[model samples]
Target chain A: MRLATFRGRDDESHVRRVGLVLGQGDHVRVHPFDAGFDLVELLAESAEWRDSQADVAAAGDGLALDEILLLPPVYPVAMRDFLTFEAHVDGMERGHGSPGVPDAWYDAPVFLFMAPHAVTGPYDDVAMPPDTERLDFELEVAAIVVRDVSDVTPQEARSAIGGYCVMNDWSARDVQGKEMSLKLGPSKGKDFATTIGPWVVTPDELEDCRDADGFLDLKMSVKVNGVEVGTDRSGNMGWSFEQLVSHASRASWVKAGEVLASGTCSTGSLAESWGRNGSLTPPPLQVGDVVEMTIERLGTIRNTVGPREESVAPVAPARRRSRLEASA
Target chain B: MRLATFRGRDDESHVRRVGLVLGQGDHVRVHPFDAGFDLVELLAESAEWRDSQADVAAAGDGLALDEILLLPPVYPVAMRDFLTFEAHVDGMERGHGSPGVPDAWYDAPVFLFMAPHAVTGPYDDVAMPPDTERLDFELEVAAIVVRDVSDVTPQEARSAIGGYCVMNDWSARDVQGKEMSLKLGPSKGKDFATTIGPWVVTPDELEDCRDADGFLDLKMSVKVNGVEVGTDRSGNMGWSFEQLVSHASRASWVKAGEVLASGTCSTGSLAESWGRNGSLTPPPLQVGDVVEMTIERLGTIRNTVGPREESVAPVAPARRRSRLEASA
Candidate 1:
């Protein structure tokens, strides 16, 4: 079953797609196509409808795909992304002088949640933040946690996933590279924009996509304009889907429709190969960059990165609290 | 007016401390906290005449202060926390073996949001995640954004803050230290648990807290088993509250009562100071390690860090997608 949220005249409309899910078609599920209802409230109210394949199939298609705008499917109760890739690790390590991480990284997965506004539709224009000049993109797989989970087992992780979508874990290369050096964490570089969807493909239909290695056999690629910059075999990821979910749900809880994204895939971005010289010159996205990314089962997501009209200098530091000194 | 969310049987109950304006009794203006009920709705629907303040006037009164749980004041539509301390930047840079970040470091502030589940009450047990054996606490200030802002000026940033609270930004020291070496942004380290509250002090009441340095004068300290392990002056922060708010709200739309935490204050935690050296050994939180933190105007928050529990390892990573690869 395919589920989506699109924009209509009054508000976002929720709809179901009839054919193979694609970006344009997916947007219609939420908007302009106007299934004539609120998807967020409806999804929360109709638990049985979400579970039944027949009920999902019966939801009408209001219009053809091209005429609509796409919103991130799964207006996630929250979104958590994990660091499960090796290349991204290597690149960051080389930037910092610290010793390398234990190979056990493959043994354990790391995850964090991005803000809800950080969620943008596949074709939406990502704003180049005013404070950042080194913005980059990360290609990854995003899965929606379908149910509430606590202390989940590997098997349970598999079942917890409701569906899958394409994620462009957009990054602030400069800010992230700088702050991550502290061995403390990445707070600024990542929180900006995290993009997902076209459509959410439920697990039942995605089972066949898994390959012999027990990982998905998706072929992933990213391009600037029409030039290919990166490519990778999804099977190269150090950890499996089940492990990420289980690790994320350990002690803590994961809620229904919460989106989890896999960190950078191998060769996920040009900065991994070409843009590492510390120069902010990989490319400034203009109105016509037409940057596009594609994963085998998921359809292509193409967007034109536009420039921000007015950017401001950073404001002065906050007022210092003086009374603490006397108390101390 | 002081606003807060307390844990009730069904959901977090919203309450407005009444005498806060009168400066007389410890009276609290209580109301049902509902996400569905906006501030206007809550104010309009409020019918409860009032609640007594006599129970809360005295400090360390276990009955009133300890029993009433505290959640991050606003159930934010969105949240963004920034890393703006020069001390943290220098320490992280040293760890990475990299040069100082460009003037951009002084020019802009970086931030990420606490997860939706991160909203914790004052007395609730902050779970020590099992993934990383090294858990640490950071004492900082967090304020909620009360206005919708885009390209806001520094002056606007000041006006935008609805209220302030004590923020305990929890960290997985080991995960963060290790991941930063790779130069990847913080994914796992800070995502887990970030606790805020006791209560939110409105911007009007905190007018004098901001000193000439343009930062708060809050004296912050963390004690484990009654021994002082960390201390800092909020005045040491490189970015002021206004700068942080301006940076966070630049392009993104910030909402009313949305919480934003200062990344970490100077010497905020053992992990940032001595965890790498193995000199900072936090006595394991036995069934009764009373961990408490305090900020001048905001108030003190006390929670007993309980004993660690055994847990299973996280599940495998999620299955990859073919469409993702194909699109790439």
Candidate 2:
């Protein structure tokens, strides 16, 4: 079952829905739920929830998956992403024509929280901040937690995983690389925005396929403005999702909606491989450049890059006073 | 206004009256909202909420602050604490007998969300995890976000703050320091459990003292088994709460109800300074250790560490068919 969050046209409110692709593959059915409702709560009450999802997939009669917008599957309580891939690290260094990788890069995985508000529908225009000239995309898989887990073993970790989703761990490479060297991480860089999903596929649907090597499957690609910059298998990770989950779950508790993304895969995206200081000089996504990312068995998400409009809506003086007094 | 979450004995819940200490002494009064309802939501809604709190305080007839049990005030979306005090960091290093701080230590303030499930009420019998050999306390102040903020300037940052509270960012020091070098952060070590209480004081009650020093001039002390370990001031910080909020709000959206803690103060508590391993070894809180933490102008919270006991209740087995289906 592929689940997604969409913004309704008239109301412009967020809704969670399950996508049912029709037999003709031309359309899909969207079953929406109330705001604040989550599948985790439903699953917690009874296993029937999973059975219903399967039943719906079997009875599919609906719209094309591409017609709808996609928001990140997990409304994460906490979003912790780690940079554990050495290949991507080396590729980044080599791409910059640098001397070598930083010595500390190999010791531990560098991680950071993707800013929570950067969430957008899969089809929403990816806003390119004026300060960030270089924007890149990385096709990766994200792990979703189904239940509260603490100090989980590798095997326990695998069972705790709710499902997988295709994630475009969007990047401002110039901002990331420069600030990361300070040893803090991409606090302001990759955190600015991260994109995920056209859909999230449940684990049972991909039975026996979540192996370490299978996870690193090399069949993913990133295309920017019709140019392919990164292509790699999923198995390229130094650590599997299970290991990452196991390591992350030690002592600390992880709630149902957390997202743990695999760092960029080797040559996974072109913008990161070619971006320069505050410049998206190569493979840059312009106002009309449609960025398309796809993973095998999971589908493709297409997003357009455009100038950021002043969405800081105008505030009338009276309304401002009222708001101030109300919150004051 | 001092707000509290308490489970009254009559099987009745009250979000009504909470205790507050004023110039004359302690008094109890009804907050303008029902008990058990999230206090953070109320704080975020009205600045006048604090004004109403003052009204409640003024009308207080003869109540006392020490007579009630206290629970963590705000419901946190995410709790990110920073080790920003140079002295506290140095003391931690000294406790570990380490030569110098790791490179990542200078990294951005490392933070982790302590499990919300671990929260206990003030005056409530605190329980220790059987496996933990060390339990420690940290004396600090926490800032609550009153409004939604993103990419805010420092000046705007100060306005985003809703209120403040006393927090004991408890730690299993050994576990934390061991894993921190691995670059993950004080995940297991510092956040296994966290205790915060006895009440929250809104910003209206806290006069602006930033002109004197970037600190909260709260006099605080900690005691174990009625023995004084250390004392410190809240204003002694490497970065002020305003700075932390500003840095955190940059490109990072902080929602109402979110909490940011100013790690521990220098010599503020035994766990942060003088204790072995920065924590009392055999860190178990015995049945009689009366732990008291006080913040000048705020109040003091007294909690007694108690022995663990079994309290498991019987559960009816699920219907047979349901069990069979689950097994299947």
Candidate 3:
């Protein structure tokens, strides 16, 4: 079953409501739940709750999909994106003149925390950072944690995932490269905005899509301004979603409403594509260009590049002090 | 005025209440506001709200400090820790065998997003990550955003800060060094736990502590297991809290209740101390060790390192697929 968060197009209060999507394509409709039916709260409940909610959804005569504005399905309490695609890692290393992937890559499923406040709706416009010239988009899939757990095994972690959705981890390449050179962060570059949604597809609904090894055999792709940029299969991930989730909870608690994303697939990002082709053939994204990302069974999320705002004032250098001078 | 979040020690409901800290040490008390008064909501209000609340707090006979349990002053909706101390950065580079600080360090106040879920109270016990043998602590000060602002100048951003608190950014150096070698994260290394608070001291209360250049002239220090390991003046930060907040707001929004922290000070961490002395002088933190961080005017926070838990099952390598084989 597909679940979404939305508000009526003309809503003055802008109250978000969880809904169950019905029908398909042009005939799509949404069965809005009661005011207290929060998506995050629902995700935290047992499977019995979902079964009961499906029954309630079947009894309603819903509103047409076009009558409402879709919001991001969940406001993640914490968000972490993992580097789980070996091909993407290898290509990125080669792009920077490295021999191959770092040995550290094979040690564990490494990840970076993302600013949850930067999340936006699937159809929202993404503003380019004023200081960046090379804006890009990453195509990937993200899982929503269903319950709180800690020090859990991969099998236990697998059962804790509530659903999946398409995600676009937007990037400002110039800013990311510079800050990363300091070996500390890619914060400002990736914190400007991240787009997620269309809707969340429950794991149980996709059992048929799982291969013999339990990896999802889903096709993922991204397009810019109607031109296809990259494509790859979801099954290509070096670390499964369960492994990533287990690694995250190794010594810390994984809370309900937290999000863990499968990092960009092979050729799922412009930078990786440029690395493989050895050229910036399509150029970087610009204002007014549309970015569309799709994953099999999870649906699609589309966003347009918005105009860049004026840059903030430059940070002044520290005053030279006797203490600093002495240390230098 | 000092603000805090607390729960009655014997209360089974575990309801958190915003309070005003009153009186001096040993005779201190907390005047709990009505149930409707929330710290986060109050921070987002106009100055008029704060003025009225102060009058209300002055009229109440409050509860003794020992009658309640203190939580982190605020559960920040988002958290960022910035590298603003040049001494710490230089020491870190030297420890890594680098010539000096990266040129990019001078461009902007760089930061990384931190897991808000990992936040613990000032006096809480922090569990060491099971995988780490080289645990460490960082001494710092953190500011809380008082209002929502976007693309604000440093001067404007300064007024948006409501109060300050002491912070301890706990780290697993062994885990951090390995992951940072891949240049994407310091996530799991630092995400297990971060302690902040005693209570938040309002900016108005610290007027006498400001230096001629407007930098806070507060003494900061850290001690482990009763031994003083490091000390520095808060004024030595290369970028002011205002500058860090301004940089954070560039092309993004800084929301009330969010936190921005000054990264480790000079010799604040065991690794940095080891670098300066050319040895592991005090040794890494171990279970049962007490870590105390103090910033003058902001108060002190003490935490005991707890025992580590068992590690989760290891993540397996990706299966060799025909698609990956072809690519290789």
Candidate 4:
């Protein structure tokens, strides 16, 4: 079943509602929750609500899908984006002048947490921060947690996922490369924007998409303006999403509504693009550039890039350091 | 004045209320935010709600401070923990085997986004993830953003802060070291728990604590299992909270209710203690161990460490790599 969060286009107030998208002849219909529903707020009660999905869908105010403005399926309480594709990791390692993939990559699945507030809809205009010389896009698949899970095995963790969606993890190359050198997580570099949405597809709806290995074999691609910039198979992830979920909850409780993303696909980002061929580095995004991403099973999410109203110097002007500090 | 979020001791329901903390000789009086007050919900409207503060304080269901359960003031939209103090940075760089504090540390502040979902009450039990051999706590001061701000100057950013609180940034040294070695982040290591509270003290109440240099001079200390482990003056921070805030919003939108933390104070964390004397590395916190933090004007936040019910291997067992993957 496909679930969606949306607001009536006619209502500028933007009151959000959870809806069941019923596919009809040519137009799609949305069945909103009886009184009200908040996707993020309802994640904790997912199992219960899921049990009565039929009843809830049977009764609700319905409208044409085009009559509503869609919002990201869920505003996750927290987000973990893992670098699961060995090819991508290898490319990144070599790009940084490192000899080879670290021994630990195979020993454990690694991930970084993203800002929950950076989530935007399928078509929101992403504000290009002034400091970034290269604004790039990442295409990946995301799984949203439905139940509170902790210290669970991969098998048990598999059940905690409620649904899937396409994710565009936006990146600011210049700022990211500089700060990451300090050996901390990417905060400002990737915090400006992350796009997800159009709709969420439940696991049950993708029964046919699952491979024998229990991974989704979805085709993922990214298009900038009208040109195709990157494409890859989502199923190429070396580590399964189940392993990612379990490792994520290893020591911490992954609360309802948290999102876990399969790291960007091999060749799914522009950084990998630059590493592949020095002469082929696509210049960063320009204002009004349209970026669209589509995952075979998880629908499409497209966004337009916009410029920040004002630009602050990404890094303040350098200042004199203490004699000892400079020498060190 | 000082604002607090609390729940009645008799109510198992964790519903939170915003209250004004009025100090009396022997006890504290809490003016409950009447039946209509929602501190967490109204955080986005911080500036507006702050306007009618006088009226809200005048009329409310009042209770003794001890009669209610104090919770973390607010679960922010996002959290930015900055590595600010030159002392702490230099110590950490040396401890990590790096030659010196990176040149960029002086150029601008660098920070990582923390899990907003990890927030717990001031007195909550912090479950020590079973995997950590070194359970540690970081003592620091935090300022909560009350208004949406973007690309603002330090002067303008000052108005965005709603209040201040004592923060305990719990860490698992083992996991953090491995992750940071990958040069990505300290996600799983630090995402497990972060305690904040006692209550929020608004800027208006902190006027006397301000120094001529525009930084707070509050004394901060941490005690483990009733033994003093770390102590430092928050005023010793080289980067002011306002500078942290302005740098935070340099390229992205810092939404209302976001939290900006002054990185761990010099000698205010166990990492520093471990470095100073390897033998003095107090045994990693054990189950039932108590950890407490006190900031002069903000108040104290104490938490007991609890054991995780189950333990998953912190790092999953290693698996074979492909020929191409192994050699990269």
Candidate 1's residue-wise lDDT over A144-261, tens digit each? 7767877788677777776677888777766766654443345556666778876767666667877665566578888888888778756667666766777766666677767888
Candidate lDDT scores, in order, read 0.61, 0.59, 0.84, 0.77
Native interface contact recovery, all models: 0.30, 0.08, 0.61, 0.51
In model 3, where do residues sit more than 4 Å from their true spots?
A46-48, A58-65, A317-328, B44-66, B317-328
| Candidate number of the best lDDT | 3
RMSD of each: 6.2, 9.7, 2.6, 4.3
The sequence of per-residue lDDT tens digits that candidate 2 reaches over residues B165-275 is 777766655554444443335444454456666667776677764425445667777777777766776655556676676666655567776778877777765654444
Model 1 earns a TM-score of 0.79
Of the two candidates 1 and 4, the one with more favorable lDDT, higher being better, is 4
| Cα lDDT tens digits for candidate 3, B187-259 | 7898899899999888888989887777877899898887788999888887778888888888887888788
Backbone clashes, each candidate: 77, 21, 0, 0
lDDT of 4 by residue, B186-210 (tens): 8788888888888888787788888
Identify the superior model by lDDT, candidate 2 or candidate 4: 4
Please name the candidate that would achieve the greatest TM-score relative to the true structure.
3
Please tell me the TM-score of chain A for candidate 1: 0.80
Model 3, residue B167: displacement in angstroms?
0.3
Off by over 4 Å in 4: A8-10, A17-35, A39-68, A225-227, A276-280, A312-328, B8-11, B14-19, B22-36, B40-68, B225-227, B276-283, B287-289, B312-328
Q: After superposition, how far is residue B163 of candidate 2 from its true place, in Å?
A: 1.2
Ranking by DockQ: 3, 4, 1, 2
Q: How good is the docking of model 1, by CAPRI class? A: acceptable
